[model samples]
Target: MGKAWLPFASYNLWSQFAPPVGQERWYCDMKRGYAKVRKREPEVTAILAEDTQPQRVGLLAQRGVYEFHADAQRLANDDGLAQVSQILRLEQESHGVKERLNQILSKYCENPILLGKRIFSLSRGDEGVPEPIRIRCGNYAFHLFAAIDCIFLEPDGTLHILDFKTGRSDFDERQAFVYLLAASYLYPQRRAIASFYNLELCKWSEPITATASQLNAVRIELMRLAQRHEWEKKQYRKNPVDFERIFPPNPGFQCKHCQFNRICQFSTREIS
Candidate 1:
């Protein structure tokens, strides 16, 4: 028989369950339910399909970097940015997207960070649904998804997992830890470290490392969260009327920015 499907966990899922440091006021569990649980619904799917401006900038920036590195000479050539822009079809994008992408491409052309590094892997940022790493914790089992942007080898032979950023969002250390945990499984023999880089701002975060105990704790926490999430899903399926009770909403000014505000009954904004 085929293997039984298990619950899944990721940094995204963790963030949905709990707010990041200092952003608690905007936290809303209902958003999670709309996004993850009932996402297959027509209205929800339509909203999710639309890539916000920030999302577009991030994706294009990552693709720009990938294209630059794909052709080593582009880093040094004066016309490299133009060539990459053509490849990206930047003209077809909105003015904001085109302008921001041009800035990112220019910055990368002037300072190609990965020019000489021994790149292990780099994602173009458009790959959908990375393969899950099957994780077994005691009697519970769940899948862990860590879509790392890049990986390179350090001089000391350590594996360096690098995540790229584009917007003003703060670097959530939980994401780095998730990547480190995945590395521990994918490269058990090698020491691994994770860090974040804002491609737009050219900002680099301090390298993050974790001990075995810390990783174990994260694993257990994810296991519990996965189990709880699965239970919530089952409850919602059994009684759709209990949706609000299962995933309570925190409607406020933040609802204006929520993608599902139009469909959310608890949304503060008028749906006219």
Candidate 2:
């Protein structure tokens, strides 16, 4: 996932890195030139988002999954490499397009692709970060992984937090609140900025507020899920949830836009 930014829907990239800065510029005094700038944005509308958490973006991205049975009907139903390759291409191009958007933002504003495939620094006191805490939640332990995008430190060291999003639509404050909870845990007492980047539209938001009330809700959810996960493991000694029960894909706009419609069981059943 080189140059991986809004480029695609892969979570690994989001968790570890971001899109390339197409253009970059000077921040603060413009004293020291920003070394990572690529393509530049002529105008700045909001705070710089640290990045997109893969789960949130993937949840709303273009996805199509097909599970083919190996029964007689499946004999002639094997997907050729072409279709699979097509899927690969879309993911690749989507990633590239996302990178382009990142480039534009970096050029226009002082936003930097701050975090990349680097170890989460946890050393404290001497300017180091500790290992990220991983807690199991509900029955969904390991449900999502998150990281801070950037801590825009003011001259006086005030902090503003921002998040990027690559969803085709549905960019709002809700998702930002999720990351804000994690960021708040990492950097307590510092007021933060949480916003979404609709890279498809090349537009970011202003006043994408981060609220304590919302962050509290996320914390509660995480805690509750962790407790549930503990109970399930002790009781079942394995995953207790059924795939069909937890992830029943109801026909809707997401299904309609799925790329694997032709071979999907749900699609065929709907047509029949």
Candidate 3:
């Protein structure tokens, strides 16, 4: 099988290179756990969906936002928000999700669509946009890929990449930067502004801009990460069955939220 393309590996420095000293077993457990679910295990997805309800609601709301604006008739439909809000109610979640969706619509409804595409765009173009833009670049080298939440092309030809966050979890600025970097590669001619919108807090992040120099730095880092990842894969291949000696685990606080914890052999007491 081909090696996996791990985008998060770029930001997670600790687990990227190797396991922490004397934690070989933990690394093996982590690797094994990931292997079992590499093909989208239904149980893992269901468990994760349950754990991240706010995120699910946020994604649904985002889709509603795109559909509402895409269809002129949707403007008059008072039930646009309510239709999406119904799922949250069925889940017995608080009214916060419904309120947050309204807040996001109110904030973005005024903007015109220069380029209309779904949440993620795999290919980039100024015209004839497609839904679900899945960015799959650097295939020969590192295989960088990402599904963007949304991309807006302003009248001035500037690109706005907005990622919606519904949960109260702290936003990782790196995620936005990674998307921005991908946008830079996909649309080099246009300048881009990337930000995070916290629907729960009804707050917008200060926009971050990316220039040619900044994008070049990102490219260099990605190349280095790709090389390192390949090296790790080679190490694993040396002893495929002996993951304990090849890919040791680094069990710690992060394990609590890890989807593979149930399958993890490592013992960690840090469960919040």
Candidate 4:
């Protein structure tokens, strides 16, 4: 139930978040930054289901919004209570931050793209996509990617991508720009931006827009990346998930609650 692009991702609470490489780094760092980090949901359930969110939101995002829900009942397993405690702590802290951010956003602006959220991957579908598109970049030299969570289409037909942010105010413009490029390449007519929902600040910024030339360049880069991976895969003959040589092994902020945290090679010191 991993994300379409995150071949490296495994399920935690049903594979809910399926965070891309960048987010994985974020997660690892969170665990290290806070000793209280823990697992929020059963890896598989969260990874594979879209029914976990509120019905209204779930229906709005039919593609899947399930991320490890730490508060669910089964999380009470006597084993690994310490880890579970960490997950609960992170989730609650996240909730508090969101409340504050929303309060701030409520006063300054109206909804940017009213009810225009759209998701891309359908991990919860029982039938696998017959011809699902696979995205690869540079024989592991490139970061695997996926887009979901908050597709805000402006009234002027510009599509904006919105991602939820639970912590500080950092933004990844390259990632969003590539998404914009991808949207233009794949959908042709739609204009998309990877927008952020600052759960703490409740503010919106003008998203980075990929110009025609930028989008074209991205397409070339994507093609070259795919070709490079194709050659490496042919030569190495390893599962993409298990392939590690292409990208240097670097763990970052997102691993704290990663399902693979237990097994990530860089997990040298235990975080208890």
Worst 10 residues of 1 by lDDT: 263-272
List residue ranges in candidate 4 displaced over 4 A.
Answer: 1-146, 190-194, 238-248, 251-258, 264-266
lDDT of 3: 0.55
lDDT of each candidate versus the true structure? 0.91, 0.37, 0.55, 0.41
Ranking by lDDT: 1, 3, 4, 2
TM-score of each: 0.96, 0.42, 0.62, 0.44
Tens digit per residue, CA lDDT, model 1, 78-194 = 888899999999999999999999999888877788889999998988899888899999988899988989999999999999999997878999899999999998889999999
Model 2 stretches with alpha carbons more than 4 Å out = 1-131, 134-144, 208-213, 225-242, 259-264, 268-272
Candidate 2 steric clashes: 30
lDDT by residue (1-272, candidate 3, tens digit) is: 74554433343342334344454444444444344323265655555445344554666556655555555555556665455345334346456655655666554444423225333332221222222223343563444554566776666767888876665655666666767877766777778888877655666788887666776666566567656555655665675565555456677876765555675566364566
lDDT of 4 by residue, 163-252 (tens): 554345356555566556556646776656666555335455566777778865665555554454445445434443434453333464
Model 3 scores worst on lDDT over the 10 consecutive residues at: 122-131
Q: What range of 10 consecutive residues in model 2 has the weakest lDDT sum? A: 26-35
Clash number by candidate, in order = 0, 30, 11, 37
lDDT (tens digit, per residue) of candidate 2 on 1-272: 33222111112212112212331110111110110110132211111122234432332221211101112232233443234234324344457444443343333223223222121221111122323444333443333345444345544554555444454545444456656656665667766565554434546676455567765566555555445434433443343343223223344344343333433344333532
